[model samples]
Target: MTELRGEALYWEAFERLKSGKAQIIDTNSPSFKFTKDNVAIEAGKKKGFVKQERYPDLCDSIENTENTRCSAASRDPENSDSIKLITSQKKKANARYSKLKAEHDLCLEKMMNLLRENFELRRELQELKKSSMQ
Candidate 1:
C-alpha cells in the first residue's frame, strides 16, 4: 500500500473533495478537522495575514488606490476609449517615446563626434603654423 504524508495527502484529499470523488464521513471527524485547519492555514499564508504585521490591510489599501486610479482614468473625457483604442494609443505613445529617445541619442553622438573632429583639426593647424614659422 502507498502511504501519503504531509501536504501531498492534504492536496490529494482536497482535490478528491473538490471533484466529489470523496465524501466527508462525519462532520466532526479528525480528517474533516484536519482539512478545515489546513484550509484556514493555507488561506492565511496566501493572504499574508500572519501576526507579524498588518500586511493584509496594507494590500487592501493598495488595491483601493489602484481601483480609484482606474475609475478616475476611465472618467476622464479626453482619455476615455474602448479597450482596443486605449491599447493602440498606448502602443503609439510608447513608439513615439522610443523614437524620440533614439533621435536624441543620435544627436548627442553626432555632437560629440563633431567636437572631437574640431579639436583634432585645431591641433593640426597649430602644428602647421609652428612648422611654417621655423
Candidate 2:
C-alpha cells in the first residue's frame, strides 16, 4: 500500500467532505446570555431562578414626564456590563464552531478509507473477469 502525503491527502479529504459523504457527531448547545440586566431580572423573577426585587422603585424610574428631573441620570453604567457578557458569549460560540470543523475533518478521513476500499474491490473484480474470459 502506498502512503498518501501532503496535498494529495488534503484534496482527497476535501472532496469527500464537499460531496456530503462524511459522518459527523453532534455537539451539545452552548450556553449564552441573551438578555440584559433588566430582562434577566424580569425573567429570573418569573421563572423563580432568583429572588424578585424587594422594591420596584430600586429599578430604573426615568420616564418622559420626569425627564427634566432626572436628565443627569440618562447615562446607565449597567449597559457596559451587559455588553461585556455578550462579547464573552460570542467568543465561546466561535470556539464551538472550531470544534465542529475539526470533527468534520475526522469524518472526511473515514470517508477516504471507505472510498479506497471500494476502488480496490472494483479493480480486483475487473481482473477476475479478464482471467475467466481468457
Candidate 3:
C-alpha cells in the first residue's frame, strides 16, 4: 500500500486505535520515555510482547478508552499508586486556590472600609464649613 502522510496518517492511527485494531503505547516508541524500553524489552528483562500494528495498541484498551466515555480509566491493581498521585496533586491545587481566595477577600474588605472612611470624612468637612458660615 502507498504510504499515508499528515492528516491521513493521523486518522489512520486514530481509527486503528478507536476500532481496537491497534493502539498507542509508550513502550518502544520514539519518545524519550519509551526509547529505553526498546532495549529492555528486547533483552527480556521486561515481560512484554511486541506486535506490528498501527499506533496506540500496547496498553489495555480499558486504560486508554475509559476516559473517552463516562467511566474512569480502569487501572490494573499495580496502578493504584498512580491514582493516588493524581489525587494528591488535586489536593495541592485546591489548597493553593483556597489561600489565594482568602487573601483576595481580605483585600476587598480593606478597600471597602477605606472608601467608607473617606466618604465620612468628606461629609464631616462639609458640615464644618456650614457651621463656620453660620
Query: What is the RMSD of candidate 2?
Result: 25.5
* Ranking according to lDDT, highest score first: 1, 3, 2
TM-score of 3: 0.45
**lDDT of all predictions:** 0.53, 0.45, 0.50
lDDT of 2 at 120: 100
The TM-score of candidate 1 is 0.40
Summarize candidate 1's per-residue lDDT along 1-134 as a digit string, tens digits. Answer: 33335334444544453344554333232223223333324333232222214233333433464466568757876555555586898899999999999999999999999999999999999999999999
Q: Which candidate's lDDT is highest?
A: 1
- Compute each candidate's TM-score over C-alphas: 0.40, 0.41, 0.45
Position 103, candidate 1: lDDT: 100
Off by over 4 Å in 1: 1-83
Tens-digit lDDT string for candidate 3 (3-48): 4453244444434444544444333222212222332243333433
Give the local distance difference test score of model 3. 0.50
Model 2: per-residue lDDT, tens digit, 1-134?
Answer: 34335323333432333343422211111231211232223222222222225223222221221353234323655655665787998899999999999999999999999999999999999999999999
Clashing residue pairs, candidate 1?
none
